[model samples]
Target chain A: MAEISFPLPDLGEGLIEATVLDWLVSPGDQVERNQPLVELETSKSALELPSPQAGKVIRIHGAPGETINVGEPLVVFEVPDNTAGIVGTVPKDDAPKRRVRLSAVLDED
Target chain B: MSESTTALLEAGARDEQSVKLSMQQALNRALDEILSTDPKTVVFGEDCGQLGGVFRITDGLQAKHGESRVFDTPLAESGILGMSVGLAMAGFHPIPEVQFDGFAYPAINQIVCQIARMNYRSRGTLPMPITLRVPSFGGIRAPEHHGESLEALFAHVPGLKVVSPSDPHDAYHLLKYAASRPDPVIFMEPKSRYWQKGDVDTSDAGPLTGARIVRPGRHLTLVAWGAMVARCLQVAELAAEDGIDVEVLDLRWLKPIDAEALATSVGKTRRAVVVHEAPLTSGLGAEVAQLITQSCFDTLKAPVERVTGFDVPYPSGDLEDEYIPNIDRILLGIQRVLEYRRG
Candidate 1:
């Protein structure tokens, strides 16, 4: 068995916290990778956060209406080793930084 | 003097003195300078090629730098943004223009999911350094949806840095800085003030992340950005007549906000009011209020009041005055915060 800790996914605009609107899963429930875990709301809009790994629900960070900050663990899971490897290794930063070069000729006046 | 000599003297005078340029011209200058300085920089957006953008901010750029560095794209915001991400990933600095604030909605999916999440999803392996230029706000009597303040929406997205310039000088320099930064930046230009004049002294400007104390005061601190900074300054001037000293803070960088600068002013003033044209509920004020409460809780003299647009879709052009926050609303909020008496 492997322990699964899911950090709060970025809700957008570099927001740090989100209000827990609703929870789709309960403790001891089986879940799959990328499964909807909970619904959260920010100043912008309501968003559904997905599970990063397939596992059995072990714990939740807060109840509905509670505000959780980004980077804080939102859910805990118990999963098989293969599932745990994919879930726990998810990247924290979502902004792509790869650099490429391009050339476009402009029309003159 | 002879006619030729007179003409030559006038030309010399024009060259000797700085030309009074509109906000769009300032933007052109900045883009032109950056592209000339760095061969890696390139620009693309709708009508940006020969037409020089709808607002003409990109005018003369295609001619000066040649299409190799500056060009136009099809009328597709998502396509523009997606291509920018692809170009940035390949190592080029692509500055895509979203013609108007209203037109940017179609690209929200790409911006929030692809551009913003790319860097974090790739574990820092892929950095989206593209700059999205969104000219927003009202006062120019534009049609519906054209004058929207969606900064809060962009600010809430992680991995995206949101920046707005209240004047021309910052517009020029900030765009340059955004081009150079490693993170993706959403640059919101205030449409109403595009023609408003301000001095652009390149030597004194600082980095893109810092905030500016446009007006220094002690009674209360007014935090604003974009065009609202101009409003705050106006309000501060009026507040002076009523013996209210209001410190105005222009939060140039909305995301990764200048917490220290904000705390310092709020700490001194012991009162605060946030102003913006976006809807009041869950606006940027919510984040700022939380930050002030957590960091400057002990310095509190009053609750942090937010003077923002009503929680409604941006209204028709005629009813915009009611939907957007104005001097009267901001002044009223300031009065409420100042007059509050603890029981």
Candidate 2:
């Protein structure tokens, strides 16, 4: 078995962080891929996050009523080797970059 | 556009190898191309992100392009328009979707005063290349606010370019062309024909400016754009039974009004009928009719006529059929123009 850590995925619409409203799974619970592992509340709405892989929950990083930064580790799971990167977490630097420059076009136009 | 580019587009439009798809599907394909080619391009509006838009025009975009390039915003028209101004000013090609034609009023001030005047306001120092997609026109049985034709409101503004595509083919090509421009464009989609299927050639399918002669005739000219184009075509087909051959001109580019193509058609037909879903008074039809009268005064056989919606708020869904111009109403307008004789 290999350990996989799941970070909070970008909830989109400029939401950078969300509150961990509740955990749907506990340590040692068998989970299937895309199972709701936790519920998160962002500025927009409440969302249930699915498990990225079929695994055994090793640890829950945050408890209920805790806020988590996007890309920060939120859960740890032990899964079979072939299914290790099933959800496929990219490194922070390798993640798709958002538009950060809005003022640069003015000077050139 | 250069002559070569124009020739290329004509070839593309006439090419038979194009894939058949609905207007909405073609729009999706074009958006996919726009996002794939341009790193600076981004699309957003209410429910545009996770929901892929109410019409599903932006469906699968957020997932494919990632949330950064395709995302949603709050339910504020002003904020969306205001933000687009800044984003366009910053050299990004931002395609902001106005949920519907009626919903655009809340942001009209920003659209008219700011978005339209950005370049002129700065004396050419700023070029706002924003493509605002607004699904407009009636016939969908959509509620009152959802089915209005307000293209004339934008066409009246000087700095803005207005375009409405009549079919799936033009919808894909015109949208891509609008997105690539240096100035702002109001891309109006006829919601009624959103699902109508047609052949769409990705290669060089003509420039965004000028009119297209969808049907050729020698007796009279029927001028229309957007949803009315289809109705006008139907009118032309039915008018054939009466031996009144009609020429149908799709004014794809509403602003920078394809005056040359329109004049040529009116001059040939000697009689004209302008059709629109907007109210008769101050509608784009009025301008087209005036242009035809001025250019083809000697060739005219009768006074130019207009078939349009009444000057009232777009009525509820039940009455929309009676409100918006239909084929029979258009044929009547045509026959009225054809029956006229100089005293």
Task: Give me the runs in candidate 2 sitting further than 4 Å from their true place.
Answer: A1-109, B1-17
- CAPRI grade, predicted model 2: incorrect
List the candidates' TM-scores in order: 0.71, 0.74
Best by DockQ: 2
Report the C-alpha lDDT of model 2 over B1-343, residue by residue, as the tens digit: 9999999998766675578877877888899889999999999999887656766678778879999999999999999999999998888899999888898999999899999999999999888999999988877666657877888899999899999999999999999999999999999998777766788876658666799999999888999999889878877767776667889999999898988998899888888999999998899988998899889998788899999999999898778878988777787787677667668
Question: On residues A1-109, what C-alpha lDDT tens digit does candidate 2 reach at each position?
Answer: 4455677888899899999888899999999989999998998999999987677999888778889999788887775522211111211112222221111111111
Task: Estimate every model's Cα lDDT from 0 to 1.
Answer: 0.80, 0.83
* Stretches of model 1 off by over 4 angstroms after superposition: A1-109, B1-20
- Per-residue alpha-carbon lDDT of model 1 for B110-215, expressed as tens digits? 8999999998999999898888999887756666767888888998998899999988878888988888888899999987777666777655456667789999
> Which DockQ values do the candidates obtain, in the order shown?
0.01, 0.02
Error of 1 at B12 (Å): 18
